[model samples]
Target chain A: MKWLPRILGAAMLAGAAGVGIATALEAPAGDPQVVELLSGLNYVPSQSNIDVVLGEGAVEDLIEIAEDSSIDSDPGLRIRAFRSLGQYDGNPQRATAASALRRAIADYGAESSGTKLLYLRASMLSLAAIDGGNAVSNLVTMLGHPSRDIRAACAQALGITGVAAAIQPLRARDLIEPEEQVRLAIADALFLLGSKG
Target chain B: MSVLAATAAMLSLYLASGLACGGAGAGAPCQSHSECDDSYQCLAQVCSPKCTRNSDCGDGFQCNEAGVCNRVFANLGDPCGSEWDCEIGQSCVLEHGDSNDDQKLESSCQEQGEGGRVGSTCIADDDCRDSLCSLGHCSQLCRITDDCPDGNRCESIPRVLGVDDSAFFAGCIEDTSVLSTTIAMSESSGTLRIPVPSSAESFAIVAEVSDKIHLVGVTRVDSPSDFLLFRESDSFEGFLANPIRYARSKEVSTLIFPSNGVQEIEPGVYDVEIEASLPPFGPGTAVPKVSVHYKLRDSHILDLTFYFLNLEDHPCKESMGIDNLDKSSAKNSDVFQDEYLGEIHNIFGYANIVFPEEPEYVNLKRERPDLDGITDEQDLRDLFRLADNEDGLAIFFVRSLPSDGVQTLGTTIPGPPRTPGGPSSGIVVALDSLCYRSWTTLARITAHSMAGQMGLWNNRDPHGITDPIGDSDSSTGNLMYFGEFGGTELSEGQRRVLSLYPGLR
Candidate 1:
């Protein structure tokens, strides 16, 4: 009975269906207020404290939902939280979300599951949504990661960034990247960036 | 009784009592209007003779337009002249902009399609195919965002994966512009009992409900009396994740028999019980329920060949024992025949090939990656070269993959007829050393590779970076879903796609 509400609450929080709640019992570890907010909804929440959380500088709390690996969080909630952070309009909180994304990419490794990889990739895209000033340089640095997925994520981030600065690095990465998917991502990034310029 | 006399008496009774009589007149029994004879058809579920056409009935009655003898206001989609003409599910609307008689604004009952076909234009979700009308056009299926039609972006096709995790590759759906007022409603329901054929190689069941609160499951136990065993620790989610334990498909509502290396069961009274929990319905609100059951009859069996390769210098090799070849071959083949594809294909009679020299062995792993640890394109072609004349699927068991679990779990050669990879489609699986064997892993890999080769796409996210079907965020118990080894069954869409395979011919 409690499971239904927990699932419904998490699903609404994430705006997705059956993302990653079925594998384990515990919700994603995060700030106590955020956790309480998520756990209290026994039924679908028609309204929430999202605006309050965002306005009261709960960007870090949202990031915790995105970053917490103790329990597998639904990608929708993390991505949504990240997007909200990107659009927060405040410089410091926005920067915090961007930095969290960077740390996630920097720490991404072989142990990452496909789902975790998706969360990280979405995180990078969140940075692009904000037009994060240093996203181009940060993504360019990520192009050298050993894992093809991270490099591809970086390429996608750069494409979404549509920054002129990413063009040269993307072209260079496109030339040397061995993985077909990563190479394609780099090509797409180059096209998007070039088109924007 | 004469028609006038009967009609007058029925009219008199109707006027006096304002109620219907079930056994009134010649008609002895009746339920709803639909069950009554032409003479008696109305909402009262009575035996009173009702008009066949509008003209026959008096002031209050008008013939129902669907050709039903009963007379009532227009139902959904019926032609209407006024506001009162339409029924509960219908609305009256104008057909033309002109006011003149030639092109006058004559209206008819208008209702949305609710589930139109792809490429068709629609004003609402109901007008679109699959109730997924978005951006004025019915949604298209896609692998990537680019595959979708213009002005439409891909959205997840829900409930096709499993309850625990999502399978992204159940195929991409377009985002609908129309917000559905009703959360979940399909076009069917009831206590449907499906008969299992004696010759069935395998069977799979899929249950998809609208809300997370609705619990849908399938079991083969004697009755729901054994439901407790299936509902472990009071956690429905946990129980759903492990359906195979309680004779249910894991996560998804699917089941395949002769499972876990067991022999086929004899034909008997196997009772398959389905469970669905209904939520509280609001008063006066009509809620539609959805339940679908499919039984694949006239089974078809496909041939399977297992080619075991060994390196002369390498310590890893297949061990032979008393009936080892037959037993292992049957076990491996069962994964295809009974576990996943059994309902559609009866995979049987596996042929094994052993290479004594290391050169051919080396060539297989190195040919494309070719023979070293994985099946390169060349490895697949070479293995199939010695397969049975009619054998369409070949699984090459190599001594070892260079990187073990990291590199050589299993791989499928993308083939012609769908994607242009090679002349044929097959799998190159790297199993554990002869002593430390795991059948589940091999079966899992084979299931993944075979599905790919058979033209089944991996249900990955739109970005297409995930590995295997499990990675796709599908919540259904589909074999193509990631996270689990064996699948409950191939989804209906998957079955339709795989039906076109040359091997199934």
Candidate 2:
């Protein structure tokens, strides 16, 4: 009869462990069917459980580690956190706190065909932010990203930001960025801002 | 070593249909992780800790990410270098950005590929944050766009503005994240687009390594009735390589194209096609079924994507392009001509059931209500329906599907198209093709130069719209300018075609 208490304690512990797994199972389920689920976009278990999913170091984080600019730089953990934040895009509260879309772009970029897709989700909160209307300040950081795609994408975002004052600055310096694509992208941004070519 | 003894070979195979092993370093003469012992998880066939000597990484590979051994997964068509590799059906080619010997963190296929998400830009792994091959791209996480950042639209470059993050730099109408990218070779407008060959429409047979030609477009045709535009002597890295049409321009596209000024090129896979005739200036129309020469270059170096013309965007068939594939039957080879007939390309080559993705005729029949593009099985239906209905239309369709997205030709296929997977669209597009060559060659010439296929195919090759418009300003007597999508200035070759057949368009 005394064993019952110990069994109860063990049961509680088991339940505690299952809570984490249950969150994961429910969280975007992380790309089931032999596919690696990206962290921070979908199936993050849940917001409450996001920490746990990230605790295990997700797939997207590994990609960051693999692609970082600084040789031998391990950006995996940082990416995991950012990806977790990105998953919040579906939720407004999450979007405001982490701006999952911006977090992702800030971390990675949309230079290639595949990356451009991230914009689909980013468009959501991006529009929301624009609606809230502090866009120019929001995009300022993105303008400096090393990737031209990101810069170009950010320029697009600035166009979405819709703040009129941004046109002059966008046109003045015009992203004297190194890459031609960046220059073209900045040119595109200015054009989007309705800057006279 | 003691590590082997201490860990006592564990037999952990996930036995499904075939033995699925977790692998404990017990395999021999293996090549990649897919070749390990029944119970071994081989990274590079080492059967222990996922790598043999460093060379086991194949070429352009390095070990990283918890000893998970990374390797480059593309090289010609058969480019998978790992066990968990994205084969023909899998959109898993890692898009490493341009490598700079000066930069330590430049793109390297050395490790696992860039399996990231769509819309995410990447300079290094730091950007991806969470490595998932999303939207046909590999990336870390959404960085700059408000999708992941604060409420911001169009951010300026922070470093220049003392704000050092993605928000200050990039912007767009939509939020975005970059996975990985290469240098944009040609201008987005393709101003440097070179002209077609001198005798682009004619047929020429030459046997010199330096024989020169220019490619206008390429379509993979099983029938041997088109043009032969590629040469064998130059263009390829290896002998016995498939022929490719060479593009002549002032600058090189990748390392693929030769030096500028001299249009002369070597042999390799090229999309552009050219025909030769001893009478290079055109005017001869006496021939019936003249065999023009061409080549299909291996543009595998191009980055791949998973997301493509979403149903909601543009003239997507599933969206508004075609309300439903109600199986319409029309008269003659086209609306105007009556020479030959064409049907769907059959994917129902049952004996050729090479990949899981290749759809069955039955499956296609079920999806007819929502079908937009053609599958192998649907292709067969096209032919069957054509012959069955006697529509007598040469149903020439072109698609810019990536080799790894749908069923792969030349080699065994992997599977059918997985929407929102592996650059759901093909990068190697058969652009600016025509159902009836002679009927639409002029418009097609204009379209091909613009990089968009205006063909009335089952599916539209968006790459047909590869170029931007507003090239010149007006389609003048001699030259045509960009018109919002693409710009085309009549080159020497094109001028020759126009002069030879006045009022062709």
Query: Which run of 10 residues does model 2 chain B get worst, by summed lDDT?
Result: B342-351
Clashes of each: 45, 205
Candidate 2 fraction of reference contacts recovered: 0.00
For all candidates in order, state the fraction of native interface contacts they contain. Answer: 0.00, 0.00
lDDT of 2 by residue, B129-188 (tens): 233322122222212332222222222111111111111112211122111122121211
| Candidate with the greatest TM-score versus the true structure | 1
Lowest lDDT block of 10, candidate 2 chain A = A19-28
Most accurate candidate by DockQ: 1
Candidate 1 ranges beyond 4 A from true positions: A1-65, A71-99, A109-122, A129-134, A171-185, B1-503
Per-residue lDDT over B1-505 for candidate 1, one digit per residue giving the tens place of the 0 to 100 score: 3234445665666656744454444333355655655555533333555544432443224445543333345655565553224443343444433334341234566543346555575555467533433323455333344434444344433211111221111122333221111113332232323322222333333343433344344433331122321232245456435423332211123233322222233322233445554434311122223222111232223344555543322222232211222223434443322332232121111101111111111123223222323313334344544333332455566533322121122222233211112223345564332222234333444555665554455443112223222323443233444322224244434443343333432
Q: What is the TM-score of chain A alone in each candidate?
A: 0.61, 0.39
lDDT of candidate 1 at residue A9, scale 0 to 100: 41
What root-mean-square deviation over C-alphas does model 2 reach? 31.8
What CAPRI grade goes to candidate 1?
Answer: incorrect
